[model samples]
Target chain A: MHIDLHPAGTAAALAVLGTEISETIGARVSALNHAVCAAHLVGVIETVPAFASLLVRYDPLLTDYDALCAQLRRLASGLNDEAAAQGRTVEIPVCYGGPYGEDLPFVASHAGLSEEEVIRLHSERPYRIYMLGFLPGFPYLGGLNERLFTPRLQAPRTRSPGGAVGSGGQQAGSCPRESPGGWQLIGRTPLRLFDPDRPLPYAAGDFIRFVPISEREFCALEAKKEGARP
Target chain B: MKILVPGPLTTVQDMGRRAHAAKGYPECGACDKYALALGNLLCGNEEGQAALEMTLSGATVAFEKPALFVLSGAQANATLDDRPVPMHEPVRACAGSTLQIGPFAEGLRGYLCVRGGIAVPPVLGNRSTDLKCHIGGLQGRALRSGDVLPIGPEPSGTTAESLRHAAGILREKPWLLRPRTAHAYLENQVIPLLRAVPGPQQDAFTEEGMRAFFSGLYGVTPDSNRMGIKLSGPSVQTIDGSDILSDGIVEGSVQISANGQPILMLADHQTTGGYAKIATVITPDLSAAAQLRPGQTAAFRAIDVREGVRLCRETAQQLRYIKELTIHA
Candidate 1:
């Protein structure tokens, strides 16, 4: 609901208030990050939001640890109010099952559901972007329905092709780049979540809802976007 | 211009890789960032300029044209044209002079910086060589014999007059780039107490396991590299045997594998890891950790997130002061 400010060095520590590790954590972290970033220019060089924590890299020369911690605390405590003032949402499209989702069967079986049911459960809920990490523009989506919860494969693939949709535990998201991953892939999204060349990538509080589409619709959207990108 | 013979482990490095840790890539850059800074300062280059990172053994390079260079870091028996050359000081070499680096007497890593920085293509916003992907640096591998490297245009005002002026300032006053001040704690085996802030997975380890981590002595294993350091010490047990989903890991993260041995992730570590990270070393001590050899012993000291932040700020101030002195000098 709010951010918790802890005393850090001369700087103040800013963390997501609750410890209940849930799907909405990323959005909350992202909201807090935007607030803190907008407030302090020198103390905050970068903010790295993880599953449960945000690592803030600051310039010590300009600000001492105590001063920074104080600033972080002040900023974090005000995040909820700031987020309420400016709200935005983003929608994502996905093609579940079939070729895009090779491991659909495995995930369905693991979660004790049929393939169709798995897709229904996955696309039914609106997910929150908990954080952006693991790669450039990689979004960590939270709020996967418990019925869809599944463990990752014991041995990870050497490389998971970029844009492969995957799920693990109660979380699911697509890979932004080819990398070794252990998440159980279920479907793929047509959207490119991260493009370094793009001005604004996915932000933390942005909403991601999977709009199920057929192969034809996916191809049409891809073509339209490609034509527009000249 | 060409590598006569590649020494043991030489690679192109800058200050450190950053903003890419979320993807499982460790900030793999120079083992000694301060030394790299000094090399750059001596050559009147920017802080993050690329330079050759030489390990215990030195490398031999044949220059096609005269170059302004500076050697810093571990004291190495370096020679040019069969004559011994001074280190930590700028030197000018003729076109045909062969620079040969011999065995190091004190430290493990050395840095050789040219006037205009290395001319390698930048990858992912950096020119530092990552040994894992075998990308970056000279053809993504250690420098070897017969490798012709292209030297960029030298910096303006790097003439004898300017160098003499810089040298005069350094000689007249106690320079902030003094390697001894930063490395004083490293002389004896009394490793500086490393402070670590607990991570999200710290709760997974048993209280005793955590205690053992702080109280027990851990030796850096021979397998340690840019990716991670394999620490050998007491076996640590976690609260649950269940595995965790892969998540982002950062430089200085101490990830405990299923086997109970702790692996301290370093620069060039994978962006993400499945193992539970109990703690993350504060950024200030990371440089010291980077310089640790395989046989070195390190002790971990637990500090709260607040204290860790304080240490980071103080260290940053120290570095800034050093940089300011360099500019003024």
Candidate 2:
């Protein structure tokens, strides 16, 4: 995999590890993210991994652009074939259609498929976590069924409930918190995508496989979590 | 201490909630880091300690016990028990004394730092209030009327003793003797000449778009906030369209929207953005961008990355100088 380094700002650089959004490139992005982070070059503040690029923010006081760039190039060259592979798979239980999935019918209508077919298509494969962005703990995944491709709403939804599973433009994402959005919602996951107490579960390169569940089961799990909370 | 009348917007902030950006959280903190640090320095508190980030308006704070605090940034009309207290100096307030910070005479944001600092529980290694997720500082929200904030224990060693006599009155030091004078100067011109480096997508802009970005003076729009400073003026167009693959966004990224109006991302910018960012404001000048008021015009000039880094180093030296000026140091 080839990585192109570009100046993002005065103190940061954008490393384009791959050109397109695909599972192979996504995995490579993860590997580079792992390698660069593991190298821990002086002055590197944080490395943010997105779809196919990593934004590395650094401190100018510790190192300048040329020195850091050379160090990053050297580090990138030595990355082992065996990446710091972390593919911890998470099984998210989701309730499809009805009140929980506000735009299920619309999605089905857009795809010219029955609601069940849409649900089956959505849950059939494991989606790769491309990045975490747009909202806290929100996962930008790439593994939507080609037929499931849909456009964003003409007018954005002012508020999307937390845990709403949505898709738009061949990308599927689950809302980690209640926020305004434009993606068409298909389902809601009972599981919390984010919690301050827990470490961010899905990093770039992790896998997310959704499990379809009934509305009743979703409520049951929600109530169980609420009951467990002190 | 009770807040007699909470300002329209006042929240506790420190450096920022970094590291958490990977989780899509914006590192919301003081918009003006230099001013905040200077205020903390004057109060003999660590720069990272929590301080109040006051908006256009200021709140009336009632001290339960005697405390030492300093104000920085905006030149606000302040009074201590009906008497005016000096800004940028340590002042001691007796129990039940009320500190009122009112409308600003200049600048938009202000910072009020206490001796030990605001003792709100820190979430994720910061006292910054992330209003989006309701995390960090005073229950993850802005200060409200009647809200009481606990003050921490006074720090052990600092310049608090040296400046004690000047308490209740303005600082006695000359303008040159005081620290960080040039860093906190108010703007006078209607247009700010912002220095920037080429963005990752700088090549994506058409020749005309590039020309407009540097040639035109854009006015800050009313729709701007901590998220970003939206500007309205000559629109820049991309030869490859405005869309780009989603990637991480920086605080000073000048993102060109579909409409082509530039939006200067700031303190509370999203972790990642999809629009094509034509340029990025340099680190040293981000403070200037933060103070830009709506309807104010701004222009940009291209500078090499090395020049921007030089400015950043100078800024760091200023911070170091302030630390050394402390009596404890």
Candidate 3:
């Protein structure tokens, strides 16, 4: 793996893998990120990996840019693409249409297809997780079918609750918490993407496949989730 | 300490959850970390000890145990059992005493640091509250009325009796151990000149746009919060637009929106952003950035990255000096 270092701020640096936004680059970035964290170098704090770059924050007082770059470069050389390319694919049970998915009718009408067709196309294939950002546990997924492409809401909703499965532009993901958003909601997930009591279910480089479920199944899963919580 | 009145917004914060940023967690901590450190040092606690960060309005509390505490950051009109308690100096509180802290007279946030720190269960290896994700510190929420805050055990050497003695001696002279740098001059009334260094996306903005950012005066909008400081100023012209592929964002990043205005990312800002960044406020000036209130005006002055790092070292030295002065001779 090869990487280029750029100054992010006074105390942080951005390690760029490549300018291209692809699953290959995301895998390479994730591999290097994991390696850097595992090394536990002094002065290094944490790292956030995006589509094609990883931001590494550190303390300048303990280590300067030159010393830190040498350490990162050394770690990058030891990373293999195979280690990060393969990640566990998690199945998310989603309930499509009706009140759970407020904009499903609109999306189906805009795409010149029936509501069932839209759901079938969306759940037909698994999407690659490029990164998790914007909000906590909010996965940025890639490879959305062009047939389902739709613009965001003209005016964003004031509050959208967690477990909201939505799509915007070319990306699709779930809202991990109640927040103001402009995504077009097409479904709702039964599982919590982010829970304070549980570890984050997904991360960058992982794949998520949506499995369509009936509204009754959604309710049953929701009840089980609540019952499991303390 | 037991909270009698929870005030407007109060949360426990330390140095923040720095390790969880990679996992989509914002590094939520005290907006003004320098002030938090000062309060901790004054109370003879570790610099990163968890303290109650009260914003705008302050909380009214009753001490269930005798402890030495210090109030830092914004200046507040506080009374302990109806007796005035001075800022920047250690004040011993007896058990059952009521401490009423009024709205801040200056600055935006104030920190209350007890010797042992606020003993809240740590979430994700941090006590700082992340309100958006609902995790960490006091059940992942702000302190409310009737909340009972437990204090951790005091460290060696800073016993209740020793603290009582130190408070008495320090109150006599006051000036000897008082760290003037600990005080944020947020009430100066004049527009603060914030120092910044060019960000990675500096080339995305035109020369004229860069000039507008450095020369123009920006007003702090009311929409500003811990997430980011929204600024209203002259439109900064971009090469195409301010939109870019979403990238990692750090505190102090000056991201120009598609509307041409700038938003300074703060402690609770998102881990990644898509707006084009023109510059980043230096680490030393972040305290000043955190103190800027709504309706106030601020200007930016460009500096090199070397100078920015140098200022950070200088701030660290100043904190060490204060630490040495506060230690009993």
Candidate 4:
């Protein structure tokens, strides 16, 4: 993983590149964010991590721009080798039809396939969490199967309620808040992807694979997993 | 406290509205964060304490009881019962005394922070008024006449001598909270140099169009508000047309509409946007952009992300040092 250092006002940022978009990359980035955040500096307040970059906010008074940049470069270089290592793959059960996936049929039709076929194709491949942004816990997963690619809505709706699973242009992610979205809404997840009250949600480099289940099984899981650990 | 006469564009504001960028909400808050910080500090309040933010014209406030207060930002001719008051200084006003903030002789916004902060309830973890969402701060709207706001607890260390001395100096002298000389910081109508990083979708624009964006001067239109600043400038041509996916737009994200004009997102902008973003203004220069009034012409300068972060850190450090000096001095 090669990291490009950028100057952002009074802070320095690390743009991690060349690492394959995978779950391991996401985890490594998250770990780096925590490590940097732990180092309390005059200007370094927080670190905002995105698909391939980590924007660290710092105080310019205590640390000069060049010094912070050097620190980030050093830290990023250390993480480069570790990010290349493999990470755990977590499975997420998704009910792909009915109310959970209001637009599943539409997506299936758009992709020239039946709803079951679309689900099968979607569940068949594993996805890498490139970054977590747009909202907390809203992972920007890359490496989607190109066959399931579809264009977003021309005019986005006023709001897409939380947990409303959506897909667009080979990208799939969940919404954390009620927001206007152009992505093709395929399904809803019972899981609360983002809970700011929680310590951490999904991190970068985490691998996620969808396991298709019946609507009945989804309900049972929802009820049984009420108090499940995040 | 009751608003006897609402000043022009007075709204309750705090530090900012955050985490709603994905929903396309601009992080609208105090336009002059430096002033707001001073006001809060003078009143011994927390950093994100709530206050009434007024623009150009000042509001007339009548107190229900004696309270400790400070006014910062724009230089508005303020008075208590027709007697001239001071700006950027803490003052103690008695119950039933009417405090009026007149029209601004210069600058745009002024912050009035009372001791203990504003008593209004917060929405979405913020008390900052979001004009677009019409939520938070005085019923999510601008201040109006006859609006009575409940005051919080009375402040300690508020005395007649401190109020008189602070107010006298502030009214007679220029603001001491000016930026350091290292930066080419401009005041009033003078626009600062805006540095930006190429947007994620910048490649969608033609190379010529990208060059035009950096070289061109854009005037902020009157249609601009907390949500976005509409700019009149050279039209930018995109190779793939105006189609793009709706995604998160942070504060300072410059979005081009179908008509080809750029709209610079501001504090109250929505979390996500579909318009093609060509550049994102660095965070340090955000305050400079916020102070811009209508008709101000601004130019975008491309800077590497490292430079942008360096500038931000430098500015923040200066502000922190000044804050410490002011408190101790």
Q: Candidate 1 falls in which docking quality class?
A: incorrect
**A52-171: candidate 3 lDDT, tens digit per residue:** 888889887887667888889888878765557466687888899888899999999999999999999999998888787888778888878889999999999998777888899778
lDDT, candidate 1, B1-329, per-residue tens: 67787788888898666655443334678877777877776776776789988877888998889988888877888888998877766788899999998978866678888888888887667788877655667766777888887666777534555654565565565444433222224555576466676664776799999898877778888888777779998888899952565545656778898988889876677665567777777666666676677787777877776666566655555555544544455
Lowest summed lDDT window (length 10), candidate 3 chain A: A221-230
Residues B72-131 of candidate 2: C-alpha lDDT, one tens digit per residue: 877788999999987787888999999999988777788899999998988888889988
DockQ of each: 0.17, 0.73, 0.56, 0.13
Q: After superposition, how far is residue A136 of candidate 1 from its true place, in Å?
A: 3.3
Error of 2 at A123 (Å): 1.1
True contacts kept of each: 0.15, 0.69, 0.55, 0.12
lDDT of 4 by residue, B1-329 (tens): 99999877889999886544322234678766767876776665654688998876889999898887888777779998888876666677899999989888766677788888888887767888877556778888998899988767755544445544544444454434433212333465444567777764676699988988887878889888777778898998898775554444566778888887888877676655556778878766666676667777787888776666566656566555544533444
Candidate 2 runs further than 4 Å off? A79-86, A226-230, B163-191
Better candidate number, 2 or 4, judged by DockQ: 2
lDDT of 3 by residue, B14-54 (tens): 98888777678888999888889878877888888999999
Cand. 2 Cα-lDDT: 0.82
Off by over 4 Å in 3: A1-4, A18-20, A73-84, A225-230, B159-191, B324-328
Give lDDT per model, in order. Answer: 0.69, 0.82, 0.83, 0.68
Candidate 4 lDDT, A1-230, residue by residue in tens: 35665443333343444235445555566656555656654556455555445656454445665677677766666665464434356676777878887888888888899988888888887777655555545667776777789988888888887667768777877675566888888776656554433434445556677777778766776676442223
Query: TM-score for each prediction?
Result: 0.79, 0.92, 0.89, 0.74
